[model samples]
Target chain A: MDLSPSGAWLVIVVASLGCYALKLAGWAVPARWLEGERLQRAAVLLPIPLLAALVVVQAFAGDRALVLDARAGGLAVAVVLVLLRAPFLVVVLAAAAAAAVLRAV
Target chain B: MGIGAAVGAYGLSFGAAGVTAGLSTLQTCALSLLLFTGASQFALVGVLGAGGAAVAAVAGALLLGTRNTLYAVRLGTLLPVRGPRRLLAAQLTIDETTGMATAAPEGLAGTAFWATGASVYVLWNGATLLGALGAARLGDPGALGLDAAVPAAFLALLALQVRARSTLAVALSGALIAALAIPFTPAGVPVLLAALAVVPLILRRRRET
Candidate 1:
């Protein structure tokens, strides 16, 4: 957590501008590139794996160690609830409640 | 509009997480205002909360934000705007807005995008402030186990998305890569590298062809 306030600001600024750049990049490209096979494939396949990566890292990794605590339990519960097709808020709050209750016990 | 506001609840979580990760209240609100993407905002705060590097945070957010680019490309033709107007569309070029625009009947694309985008932006940012203030008052976040909320939410989303065979394969592969890589690389690196699952996807597609 050595991030100075300024350093955090820098990251935010860059991320915001980078987002704008991506949006502009879409418009800047000829319509052909968007229709091209390679980009299309990327658009389709990239999010699945990328989102999976995010879920794995967030769920499993804790302080550089993979610890299965309440978070893991909560994640499992959330997945099951989602499979059961619960509402979005119910899924989220239920997961958190599961984690909190598990931690308390 | 209700969906937009519901998505806004994500802002509440971001506000809390950002504070837990050591950002000032002003800074957290500033992120909600400027970055305005839930996943990216969460990535920044998540990486930092886990003591990951700032650069890694930015990289992860940028990676996730690329989805908006895809949205933009798809929405570009449908939205009839240019110059300054195009900028408005770009600012609103997010998952919800693009989704709304795409699903709208015929000529209603512009109305759908603008309306949903405006509601989400306003409600999400407002909810962020309220959540931040509440969290700031709650003192330490660990007491309530709010730390678990982010990963749990992401897990819920993954569960919904991974119903198909191809998605399941990619998700499992990505998880394996991240688990294997965690010990050696920096915190966020493994997550980004998991995108290498794309390689196998491409190879499979080629073989099918």
Candidate 2:
């Protein structure tokens, strides 16, 4: 099959290697340093902001101009799903349906 | 994390997107197999679909991947494997694997990590192929708002992380950053901002007794 140029494959290889390097760096570092209190503390708290930023980006990025489009409508549906504690599958379907309908209209 | 199912479903969307963007099934599968990161893969495809340069898309994907560096640091110590095994372990170290593995109790960490990663890998790639084959019939997944499913699923994952004491602050910070950045940065940048927002909290914890 004709792929999108061999260069794209190279991109995949490099990206994969780069990701692996980061993963390996953790073990490659000395045990004592990694196990230290500072690192431990950082790990414990890192998720909060990382997750926060992620949520922010997801919610508002496309709404940049703040035009109330289907994406925004879908996001509202997602908010409701979270509030209702809907199952993941349910929430996803709800949001996707909302977006699809919005797009169609 | 239970987000594995959502991730798998999203892979279907990605597969469909790949086909629409002129990628073949083998190419889509290769993308999933090699660069298993969802957000980056999506960004790359989005860029490619938008007629952006392949080189630029690759660069954007790499930059977005910087956060995995932090995951490596955090999870590497939790589940240490030797040389060759380390390669496979790294391949499996996505958000779900790292989050589930790190949170699991001592003896169960390894098992949880492997299970989460392996499960996501299989389901995601399988769904990708399915999506690719059915791309024509699948229509617009975004039109169906399947795209929102991921963020909603992620929100559910976040809810599971909230404890009684810090739940409000954590949730607020995430919301605030997401809201603030949505207008400014691109898709992945907001996630980076969210990760960065936690740095102050980490610093505060360090200063405490």
TM-score between model 2 and native: 0.69
Candidate 1 lDDT, A16-105, residue by residue in tens:
898778876776676667776656776666666766776677777866677787778778887888788876667667777788888888
Error of model 1, residue B83, in angstroms: 1.3
The digit string of per-residue lDDT tens for model 2 on A6-92 reads: 765666677667656755665566655566665565555555555444444444455343345575677778778778887755765
Model 2, CA-based lDDT? 0.64
Give the best candidate by lDDT: 1
What lDDT does candidate 1 reach at residue A4? 90
TM-score of chain A of each: 0.89, 0.64
Clashing pairs in 1: none
DockQ of each: 0.62, 0.43
